[model samples]
Target: MSGETNRLLGMAKEIMAQPDGRELDMLASTGEQVSVALLAIALQALGKQAVSYAGWQVPIKTDSAFTKARIRSIDDAKVRKDLNAGKIVMITGFQGVDADGNITTLGRGGSDTSAVAVAAAIKAAECLIYTDVDGVYTTDPRVVSDARRLKTVTFEEMLEMASLGSKVLQIRSVEFAGNYKMPTRVLSSLTDPLTPLAEEAASGTLISFEEDKNMEQATITGIAFSRDEAKITVLGVPDRPGIAYQILGPVADANIEVDMIIQNQSVEGKTDFTFTVPRAEYAKAVEVLNSSVKAHIGAAAINGDTKVSKVSVVGVGMRSHVGIASQMFRTLSEEGVNIQMISTSEIKISVLIDEKYMELAVRALHKAFDLDSAK
Candidate 1:
């Protein structure tokens, strides 16, 4: 798939000086269209009734964002009709039509978002996401040999993990499912589809509300880590009202995301502010700050480092537990790892660390929190 995209990108570069977003979406959407058509044909060859439909045919309406459209609404009239007629219907994913009828493709991994949106529109009982891994784990199994498969996880924990870098499901899809209270299962595509539903439930992890009594009770559900993080610090800024906004407003205006912001305790009348951004945007964010933001805000200097990563411990049980944060800090310190910045929410604690120690921090935290033994 990546090779095909690269080939198309090369062709576009050769054919046009600069391809517009609309044109790019139009070209990229053909990939999903072809996939659904081929899959439909394969099913028909097996003597089953199957049909393929494009996003416009089923009318998955989205905003006119071109390459990163958000689903505005989905009209299931044609889908329901086709299913009622005893035919298995397949629709192209990752592409939707705007109200203006222009072809728009969702961003990378938008197919997962499209599937979840459709399931919500139809009010399906459960949306099973079949992937290479059997289910969500205590940690990345490749990183930890004993990373156990979770039978069930609360939506809050799943959200934290997905956003922090578990990558089993798209973060937006998880948010959409949680909003509508949709049940999603992450199971292996290698399993037989004809298996009984009740028996198959044990093969994958179920993401449900915390109200589920069967959810495994644990202080820390998992440790998630993300690399390619860069830190930026603005030094000697007046510690007054709206100082944060003054420093970050330009980055936001330029569409650069800021994460894990921390302001040092005020010293005299000034303080130092620090934050992290994706490594790809680190240079751009620094340029924005150094160019004028520093002088305008009366800050002394700006500094940045691109060799950082974030580690987070997530669990719904943390809301009612004590000492989780201290335990996490102690575990990292005992492993000779240093925390660069810290951020926390009700159910999660995240810290920025040197990228080189990311694996060490995750492994130490996993064992410290007893995640390896979690059911």
Candidate 2:
């Protein structure tokens, strides 16, 4: 697949032409279609009654967004009927069609989201995700040698971890599963699927609601980190009402997401505002803020750094716990790591620091929180 995609892209580059989102989507969707057809063929060869359905055939409806379409609804009648008829129904995972009958593809990690959406539409018992890893780990196993696989994790924790850059599950899919109250399991595709379904499930990590007993045992469920962050600061802005909006309006209009915002106290009626955006959007965000935003909002200068990282500790038990924040600060301080910006929610606390300290911060925090062992 990689070779094929590279070849396709190389040809496009040679032609000195750029493919629009719609064309890119159309081309990218063929990969999933091919996989579904091959899988269906393999199933039939194994003596199973099997059939393959494209997204348009199953009718996974999504918005008109060409490359990053969002699923609006799905028609499950075909799949249901096929299942009742004792035939396996295989649907292409990521691509869908809009109302105008235009092909659309979801962006990165869309396949996982598509699977969850289908499960939700059909009211399945659970959605099992077959990935390269057997289960969610306390941290990236390659980074932390002692990282342990979790038996179960609350949806809140999983959502936070995913948003904080844990790649075990896609953040949108986790949110969809949570919204539909669907049980999800993470299992490895490298393992033999012939294992009894029940036994196989036990070997994976179950994502459940916070009311479960297992969810209340840990204040910090795991450590998540991402290096794809950049910080931007708008300095010397008047500390008047709606200043935040004045500074961030253009950024939002440009479709750039702002994360980990900090507004310092007014100093001589002026304040320094700092925030973070995805590294890819760093230049665009800075440009948006510097062009008209600085003058309109009465700001002095704009500064940005692309070499920043965010690390977070996430858990449902955080709600009932105390001293977790202080302990986190102390742990990082002991490591001689300086925190740049901080953001917190009910389930997570994320801090931005120099990118160079990302791994050291994760390892230190993991050890400090005792995340290498299961609760």
Candidate 3:
């Protein structure tokens, strides 16, 4: 799939100076289009009536954001009609069309988002997401061998984990399911072809709205880590009102998202500000600030580190638990992992750490929280 996108990208560059977002989405969406067509063919060969449709065909209307489009609404009438006619319907994921009839794509986990959105639109009983891994784990299984497959996780915890780095399901999909109270399951696609329906129904991780009574209120439900983070610091800025906006406004104007921001206490009326961005946008963010913001704010030099990563512990128990923060810091400290910045919410605690210690930090946190199934 990536090979196809890359080939199109190369072709575009050769044929034109640079590919615009509209064409980029037009090119990228073909990947899903091809898959749906093949699946429809396979089903037909198996003696089942089936049909495939693309986003524009269904006219899944989206805002005109081009590559990063958000689904405004999904017209499920066509899918329902196909299903009513006794035909299996396959709809392309990750791509939608605008009212202007321009093709757009939801960024990153857009396919998962598409699936959930469609399920909600059709008011399905549940949405089953089949993926490579069997289900969501306490952490990346490769980093922590004993990471447990959660039978069920609360919707909120899953949201935090997905945003933090538990990539079993993307955060946007979870958000969609949560908003509409949709029951979404993540199960493996590798199950036996003829697995019993009852058994398959009970397998995988169920993401629900706190509907699982057996879910333990573990202080740390999971350890989440992401290496795709970069930190930027603006030094020696006046600690006055709106200073933050003065610094971040331009970055936002440039479409750079900021996360885990910190501002040191004023020292002689000046403070240092720091924040994190997706590593891919770090260079562009710095350039935006330097070009349009720095001198206007009368700040000192700006610097960034693309080698940093973020580690977070996510659980609903954090709201009522004590010592969670201290224990998390202690675990990382014992592993020689230094925390650069910190962010927190009712269900999670996030800390920026040197990229080299990311896996080490995750492993230590997993052990500290006793999330190991073998234990």
Best by TM-score: 1
TM-score of each: 0.94, 0.93, 0.91
Clashing pairs in 1: none
How many residue pairs collide in each prediction? Answer: 0, 0, 0
lDDT of each: 0.86, 0.86, 0.88
Error of 3 at 68 (Å): 2.5
Can you write out model 3's per-residue Cα lDDT over 1-375, one digit (the tens) per residue?
A: 447666766787888886799998999889889889999999999999999999999878899998889999999899988888999888889899998898999988898999999999889988999998899899999988989988877899889888887888888999999998899999999999799978998999999776545334545679888889999999999889999999999999888888899999899999999999999998899999889888998989898899999989998868566688999999888888888998989888999999999988998999898899542
Candidate with the greatest lDDT versus the true structure: 3
lDDT per residue for candidate 1 within 289-353, as digits (tens), equals: 98859989999899888999999999876745668888888999999998999998988999999
Which runs of model 1 end up more than 4 angstroms from their true locations? 1-6, 16-18, 192-201, 214-218
Model 1 alpha-carbon miss at residue 262, Å:
0.5
Give the candidate order by descending TM-score: 1, 2, 3
